[model samples]
Target chain A: MPHERVIRHGRVEPDAWRFVGLDEGEDLQALPHGAIVVPLAVWKARRDALLARLEPLGVWLEPHDEPGEIAADLPRLALVAVRFPKFTDGRGYSTASLLRRRYRYAGELRAFGDIGRDQLFYLARVGFDSYRLPEHRDPEAALAAFGDFSLRYQGSVDDPVPLFRKRAAVEVRHG
Target chain B: MYRYDEHDRKIIAERVAQFRDQTRRFLAGELSEDEFRPLRLQNGLYIQRHAPMYRIAVPYGVLGSRQLRKLAAITRRYDRSYGHFTTRHNLQLNWPRLEDIPDILAELAEVEMHSVQTSGNDVRNITTDHFAGIAADEIADPRPYAEIVRQWASFHPEFAYLPRKFKIAVNASAEDRTVLKLHDIGLELRRNDAGELGFRVHAGGGMGRTPILAEVIRDFVPWRHVLTYCESILRVYNRYGRRDNIWKARIKILVKTLGVEEFRARVEEDWAELQDSQNVITDAEYARVAAHFAPPAYEPPSDDDQAFAYAVASDRAFARWVGRNVHAHKRPGYAAVTLSLKRAGTPPGDITADEMDLVADLADRYGFGEVRVTHEQNLVLPDVRERDLHDLWQRIRGARLATPTVGLVGDIISCPGGDLCSLANAKTLPIAEALLQRFEDLDYQHDVGELDLNISGCMNSCGHHHVGHIGILGVDKNGSEWYQVTIGGRQGREAALGHVIGPSFAAAQMPEVVEKLIATYLEHRVDAERFVDTVERIGIAPFKTRVYGAGKELARAA
Candidate 1:
């Protein structure tokens, strides 16, 4: 048998968690542990009430408005899903960097919406742990984009020290 | 010149390696034409009308003798023994082979230069007043800020692919010699009432396809926020600029569509979020960069020669040359001289390898081992001492570079049109040659006085035909080349786009048309008025009626 789906807050049925946003009367507060996703507006409006209940059970938040705002709640927020809105909109990348650096939030940062194979390396550089591929895209091909460049010119979250610093350190050691 | 730091050197080396791999993959068929197109473009290699053309970046048009020698060596090795200096202060090699591009890039990297970001839908070579540090009229040197912008925009992950290519020009000079209004982002450095240096910013100006003048977006942006604010504007453009049509993809189209007020508001909104970011330049960093561009140590010479004045008064030919060619310098005993490349029967902006070596040698001997490539497609020795003017003039005359037509009609701005560029509709060089031959009389040219005649092979406006006081555009009618003339376009501080005078004339009739236009200007102008001022005063009606009607009649009779 498949693993048992855990539902919280008594408002949602375990079987109906996969497609919560489609229904008008769906109770987002009682979303199942693994599959449910919430819109940014709903999460922002009832964030306090949702955090009160969701903190104990450890729930994932999809499309969080302020990743920095909810960073203190990272122990419970298993995965923070960021939205791209458009491929060229780079605010989410900055938001992710801030979440990782300032808050030291180690939970998975998943990027979705218009995320293409070409933008993967940059996403990785800014601290995105995983990506929700756009529908109809091959995940294996998209995975290859993460390592397109073997070397980087600048320092980033993934590599806190720049290439020059590292090279100089190595040179000093050998010299 | 800003010497490459370790980081800068490493970045260029890595970028060269990246391009080498990309080229190898392209040769091995691992990358398709479409896949490799943007990569090659970002590396400044373009598949032009005939072969691949590689534009090497010469940041802010200041080059030392060593860098120039590298360019000369590159020309001799990878391309023909010639290169074209573009209006954006970069150099273009016409005949670079595709397979040997990697080796060429390696050579460029060795000299602290590369073709990166020279062409593409990315931040192109950031240009500033060519006479930045050396110009007497300048309030501040603009190269440090230009270099800062270059570093910030180079291979920027977010802005690498924008709506279209972006150009930024900074001018700190009183006269706006860099044609700031023709750039996408025109910055004028100004000091506030409190004596704080800041920038007055303009946005959305461009020339290709739909020509539009830039509109002032900010009265004064503080110097600290220059990089972050510019990045914010680029971010807004990258997100919202049209991508559907290639022609309408430039920021000018968006500015036109949203109106300048709305565009300014959008940029402000973006800047508000980025104002306090890490990208904001600090005072220390600003000082560090500025220190790199501080003026060279100069001891004031005691010898003041009135020889040039006496020579000019004595010799009419030399006087005419001085009147047209010599520009005042800020230093007491120096002047900047423009060696006109638009000599009769020579292709505009084409200087042979031998000429380049000679100019390089002259720069070492006379002018501080530094040379500048001007936007008007001429070579400038910015620090020629007044005392050495005669000796330098003799040497330049021997090399046939003393054309004595700096701002005259014979100093025509012509593009490498159908002969080189793929986008041209008609041949521009031959037409330029014809006009130059007709206007060869030095006395007649000086009498005409400060006429800007620009020619572009097409409406892409690389030759900046729209802003020329006397503009000539090459057009194709049936199977033959035709020329369209316009009047009163000026690209200086009081920038204005030229207006089309009338119908197109055949190639053979181009010289006659130019003659009639000049004659009309002379007849109708108030005393000492320029071609632009005369056209502005009387309008194109009197000039057009005379040139197109009675002037054509006179030509027919002759």
Candidate 2:
């Protein structure tokens, strides 16, 4: 099979994990082989069975799925991926921030589906560690988007201290 | 005016570069139209009916003389010889080539003005009372808070792609000049008995297709926590605001569907986590921003102004202009003057390049080096010496900018309807022209007294017709243009939406219909009673009866 490219920390890398999706009423017994990410519903329904099988488990969420649902499962989970149905559907940014900040999810957080270079910087600010680039976009050229701005005003998961507080700290140090 | 710091300047410069690249990619056929639409719109570029419309942001309605000169230069160089000032305190260049926009943005960045967040689904330019800081009845200077909010909302990563366009307005004065009730989030700065500053926060108010007044989400949010509080409101709306339908996507729909109480509860729950977060505003930061808005150097305050009194006594024209156009300044020796843009022949908010240069010169000479754009589509020199009234009046009269009808019948707020806007249902400028011709006489208009006659081409309410004392809305009937009239709407301390009088009328009969309504007000009004007051005292019946009852009078008048 051809390599599935992922932009992780502004570097192009081959994606290692395979996403295993389940349709309605599909049994979780038939699963993909290597390090795999399952749907949140499937993981929730067959938690013990999936834990029993040693496939290095991870879970992915749809746009409407709340991060709180997977809060308690963060410790055991290896990675969490949020799906963006469309580029403009921005609920994933908020969800990513909640997972990192509120739920304190320390594992790898990834954004997949319909994302492009334009969304990379914003996704990084909200604590997404990896991105699945569309097939048409060149991953090497997309790295330029991360350095688009040298300054930001608001606090986010990347920098919890806002610019104003940083400026205040500078003032005190100079004094 | 607040000058951009190096950090602020860097952000805007980077944004211009980013947009330039985006435009190049789109032109190269690398990005689809759907993908490029939001990117271009967030930078305030719109594909309009005839050409691309570029909106330049005037943050909190403040402009320096140098910036106005740069705008004038850009207008003359890039667009047609004129640009329209929008009711949101923005400047719209109607006819500009798409390729020339990056260069225009670069020139704009030189003057520290950018069009970011002027359109699209992001936090728009924060607006406040045009008379902020100088208004006699103001509780506190609202500019600092507005500037703070502007910085916080600028290029916000999380809330950039909201369900729809969001607007926030701050007001500290007793009067609601900023249309506080019509914004998605309205912040009213107040002081408690202990002299602590806080905001009476209202959320979910809007005026598009469905007009709903915002409810008090939090009666008092301390100044320190204002940013976090605003974040809570935005986050709730961002996560849950409907994205399926464009019409029902505003926070107002979400607020209405869940009810204000539930909305408030969700916001409070969100705020609980963010209140102590790093986004909490600091006193040092507030002071740093507030220092930019401190009062300009003025002569010693004195009640006696012999020159001003002599000018008023000598020239009746100057006295009339003073009576109508000049607003009372908080300082004894100064007054704020509104330069009327609503002359008879021209469109309401349209300003030519030459006129812009002249206004810039006038601002430097007569007042402070700053000017303000009123939401009523007029320019204000916020700090003019009272003694310069006669000189200023004489200087501006020849340009027809000295119209003494600031709040009168001739002062109509209108949107660029079908003549320019693709979304408009009918042409509004011609009707505005007809009304201006009918009420051209200064004496007749002054006799009519304070009235807000606003016209909108559609339900978007860009003209703010819903809050006009006499509102005219354009409706499409059978593929033809028709006018719908509403009565008794008033904005200010008590903001109320107008009610429709009767049925819609043909476009040609609009002036006559307005005449009939004004005649009814004159006939039924008690001494010194305003048109809206008379309509309120004796309801909309008499106006309706006259406007609908008089078909013969229209023919006679025509």
Candidate 3:
């Protein structure tokens, strides 16, 4: 794919990570050099073994194994990718935001599995810094959707001060 | 009414553009129909039987006269020159082209409005007491807090998608008017021992196929942490709420299955992580929003003017209206007047563009340039002076907006039902039309006294049938529409779901069934006992035996 793959802070970048889905069951011993994303079940079961490896590692959370459940293991994970299972099932949006805001998982938060161009904008605002788009989607348009709104009301992973606080700060400076 | 600030305005403007792009993509076949459904629904656009229906959120049911006039203009230009006020206090335009929705949203954004999350599986428009600031019994106005929550919840990334549609209602009055117990999360404003305002939180209450009253989640949460507390609840619901079954998707079901104790424990787990979060509302933030809802300028107390006294004393029609449609206000010389939308033979909340403009003009003249939409599906002029009420009443009556049945039999709360809603099992407007015509006599209705007849086209309870004094739910029986009647429901400080009377009745037998229920109540009444009071005093058995013949066992629990 020629178009940029991930949008972070209104800019896109080429994809790098290798997502080894649970269905694939990739051989952990013979993994590629780049970052490897494994399933939650795999991560939980082989936590000791995976941590001992030299290569970078992360876990992909399905809708049910949300960020709230894996809080204790968040410190060592370098790239947390939350799978949508289905684009319409938005439980991952909460999982992504909580990983960034609550669990403080300061890794590359990405959206995977059934990800679409339209959902990328919302997913990005909620703190997904990377994306693994479905094969047919246009990544160029998905990247442009990130800058769709220049103003927002609530505080989020991207902007900590909500609009009201921002307005208050502006008022104090101008007055 | 709360005026939007620059930030609020800009957000709405950008939202219009955002939805515009989404609509453009959908039209160009960049997004599939399945993908576009949530995008349109969250923006308050629904595909109905014949045309695309647009729902405009009237947040907390308070809007300026100028906003209403704008709505009139929009409905006239884009739709069929009218809009219907929803039971959730939204304005619905029944006929609009799918392509025109973006333009409509753009027009709405000019007035600091857009229908963001009137539907879809997200946090819907937060609701509260229609008589928020003006009511005499309320400890404090809840609109400020409601606004704060509204801003926070708007475009909230994490909560944008959920298992099912979520609803929140706030009440400041000692007596709940917004039906707090029927919401996903209910907040009641009260003061603790230190005399500082806080909220009594109720979670998991909702009306649908399964009706359950919300149990108390927390005794009190201070005003400063309201937003954080709410976010905690949403996080738990989003992360753990069932996605396998659409039937069990609402937060109410999650609360039921987990039990309120476990639900609170899960929420506390979420709140524990949010202790030092920036989402905590500051005093300055609360005050900024509160300033927009400051009390209307009130005049000093005055004795009843002779003209007002004489007008009511001489004309029994005027007297009956003043008796039922008017409510006491906090200001001594002021009154709040409810303009009945449930006129005979009309859809319950349907108001023409002409009526909209007229109501706006009346609100400017007699009120503080504001109108309120109530949960009971009516409009309220909240700041009318008692001295000017007679003339206001006269003008309102001339406009055909005056129906002297506020809480009486004629003031039915109904949904658009099968008329426009694709999910409805039956058309509800005809039922409303029949009941209104049957009980057109003011004396007959007044003598009948204080009955709430709520109807829903389906079990979604958009009509809030579960909490009505007498609830009627539309059931689909192998292709025909049947009405199931329930009695003794009440919505207030002591909210209770109605009990099913018996087997469902056909369309023709509904009025007779309701008449029989009323007749039974009147026979057993002691002095001023209402239909609800009488039913409560006795039980549903007498009413049941009368409607379904003697010796019939109860089919459903209350």
Which runs in model 2 stand beyond 4 Å of their true positions?
A1-3, A22-29, B302-304, B550-558
Model 2 chain B poorest 10 in a row by lDDT: B549-558
Q: How many backbone clashes does candidate 3 have?
A: 0
Which portions of model 1 show Cα errors greater than 4 Å?
A1-175, B304-306, B476-481, B550-558
- Candidate 1: residue pairs that collide: none
Model 3 lDDT per residue over B163-264, tens place:
999999999998889989989999999999999999999989999999989989998999888888898999889988998988899999999999989999
For candidate 1, lDDT tens digit of each residue in B1-558? Answer: 688877777778877777787788789976668667877988999898888988888888877777788888889988889888777788888898999888998998888888888988888888888678877788788888888777767766656667688999888998888788878888889888888888999888998768899888898888877876786677667656787788998888888899988899988976886655656665655665687877665558656568877887887767666777777877877777887777776787888777888888888888777888888888888788877777788788877788998888888888888888888988888888988888888889888998999999987888888889999888877867777888999988999999988788777888887888888889987889998999999899887887679455633422
Best by DockQ: 2
- Residue pairs in clash, model 3: none
Every model's DockQ: 0.11, 0.76, 0.73
TM-score of chain B of 1: 0.96
Say which prediction, candidate 1 or candidate 3, comes out ahead on DockQ. 3
Error of 1 at A132 (Å): 7.8
Give the alpha carbon lDDT tens digit for every residue of A25-119 in model 1: 76766655544445555655666765655432222333224555666667766666677655544556656665776578887666666666556
Q: Give the alpha-carbon lDDT of every model.
A: 0.76, 0.90, 0.86
